[model samples]
Target: MTMRSTMLLLAPAVLGVAAPALAQTAPTILPDATVLEVSAEGRTTRVPDVATIRAGVVTQGQTAAAALSENATRMTRVLAALKQAGVAQRDIRTASVALSPQYRYAENQPPAVTGYQASNSVSIRFRDVAKSGAILDALVAQGANQIDGPSLSLDQPDAALDEARANAVKIARARAELYAKAAGLSVARIVTISENGANDGSNPQPPIYAMARAMKASESTPIAAGETQVSVSVSVRFLLK
Candidate 1:
């Protein structure tokens, strides 16, 4: 083939590939869209449905075996009393069991082992909050010396969390719409949605300093279980046109 013929044939192939590249490099022209991002929280409160109680027995004796034996006997009564008070077997859990030696120290002498002390504790969960205080009295009658807690919680926390999540989305959408309207723009659609998290926001109550030894006050052990609050937050982005 002649030089002119070769040039003519190559020109078409080069132009065919260049055409696709030119189309790819072309800029797109579309309506300018704005975005509105917002974060919001939802909270709900309801009466607590469950209460947890920690109770135990502490015994002392000259020997470790004697101390442990006495503590075990008392702890048996405590467990029985819990059952008698209507606490289910599934709700009762052993927390701890330990035996430690008591020491007596002199000003310039090494410490001497005086005796041994044994402690046994168990945790109980009461579904019926109304009977908690009365049950506590029952445990005291059964020889429980160390008692702590009436820590309150909700039986079905998932229910509260679900409600909060729904409310969070609704509130976030309302906030985004308000901002868009104030800016003289209209919300086209929701572009994205993300859940931050849910938190109970309640601190655990510390054990009472002196209640460990006493079971009942002069009157019926009075207990007040307040409401349980659940909080949820969410983030949303809305396309504004």
Candidate 2:
């Protein structure tokens, strides 16, 4: 080959070998980040703005039709009483209706049906907690034979939950920073946040609530709507510097 041809071939090979090194410059590497994990719980206490109750009637008669008719009549009166007590129609709901045969037992013999029984129930929501007692009193006076829970709750829970969530986040961050500082490190930034659970407390029917069962026509049923607690829990991880 001529010298120029040889030079051209050699130059191409030299440049090809140097291209990889030129592209492979040292890159800046970041140090491993340290993290702190923390968990926190937050709670807020607020009075329930709404209450729910279940009331019903049970009747029996010799015939199925008679028992059902009596139950229907009683249930109609009970519903009217609820409406008069300021319970909106939308808030009153028919929970259940059932008719069953009543049986009598004899020694060493198969039981025989003695009569027919009918039952009807309603679930009511009392928007005004203060008036729930009076409403319950009216229900009893209207001949409600079966009564159940007055479960309490907030009408709208978003605001309460938001407050609780904010508190949880603030506490979680604070604790994470405290732990990081104790370990001779500074908080760099929040790495991740996760919610563990949230709960709005229950309105358990206390023994005192049973007093409504015996309320007289002249007496107002007394009910104590205790405070309800909203709770939130969170887990957080923060970067430590």
Candidate 3:
């Protein structure tokens, strides 16, 4: 074949390959689109089913050994009373124990050691709410010098969580519908859904001093556990039809 004829044939093939490369180099812009982000919260309230109390003995003596011995004697009586009151062995546990030196500080001199202090604390779980007051009174009479806590809680939280989750979904759907209607668009299917699990508020706090005094003086502590609320939140994205 002649050189001019061969050059012509090669030129067409090169141009064919370059055409696609040119198209790839060109920038393409996407059409405008709208996305709606909505957040919904749900809450469920329920009465607590269980209670926990921390009670113990604190003793002070000239030496650590003597202080610990005195604390042990009182703690033993307290534990025995708890067991007699129908508290299971597994439900009772030593939460803390410590021995520290008591300090006596003079106006300008270095602090001096006055005595040794020993403290032993036990945590008791009460499944029966009706008997919680009686149990506390028994511990006090048996020698529990330092008593704190009866943090109430729910034994089984699964049901409450389920209710919260369902409510969250309902709230999200309603919000999406509201936005869609306001913008003059028909309600469409959910494009995406994300959930944040239940956030039950802060840990239970012990009763206030006034309530505690009333409880202490009454024949039986007027035990009342108000409802606790569990809440859940969710974020949802919906596609416009």
- The C-alpha TM-scores of every prediction are 0.78, 0.80, 0.79
Report lDDT (Cα) of residue 1, candidate 2. Answer: 6
Angstrom error at residue 36, model 3? 1.8
Instruction: Pick the winner on TM-score between candidates 2 and 3.
Output: 2
Candidate 3 clash pair list: none
Over 40-102, each residue of candidate 3 has an lDDT whose tens digit, in order, gives 777777787777778888889999999999999988999999999999998998999999999
Q: What would the per-residue lDDT of candidate 2 be over residues 150-240, giving only the tens digit for each residue?
A: 7888888777777887787787777767677777888777645566778775565642323225554576766567788887776655667
Shift in Å, residue 102, candidate 1? 2.1
The number of the candidate with the highest TM-score is: 2
lDDT at position 110, candidate 2: 98
lDDT of 1 at 165: 70
Q: For all the candidates, what are their Cα RMSDs to the real structure? A: 16.8, 18.3, 17.4
Question: Sorted on lDDT, highest at the top, how do the candidates line up?
Answer: 2, 1, 3
| CA-RMSD of model 1 | 16.8
Residue pairs of candidate 1 with colliding backbone atoms: none
Candidate 2 to truth, TM = 0.80
- Per-model C-alpha lDDT, please? 0.70, 0.71, 0.68
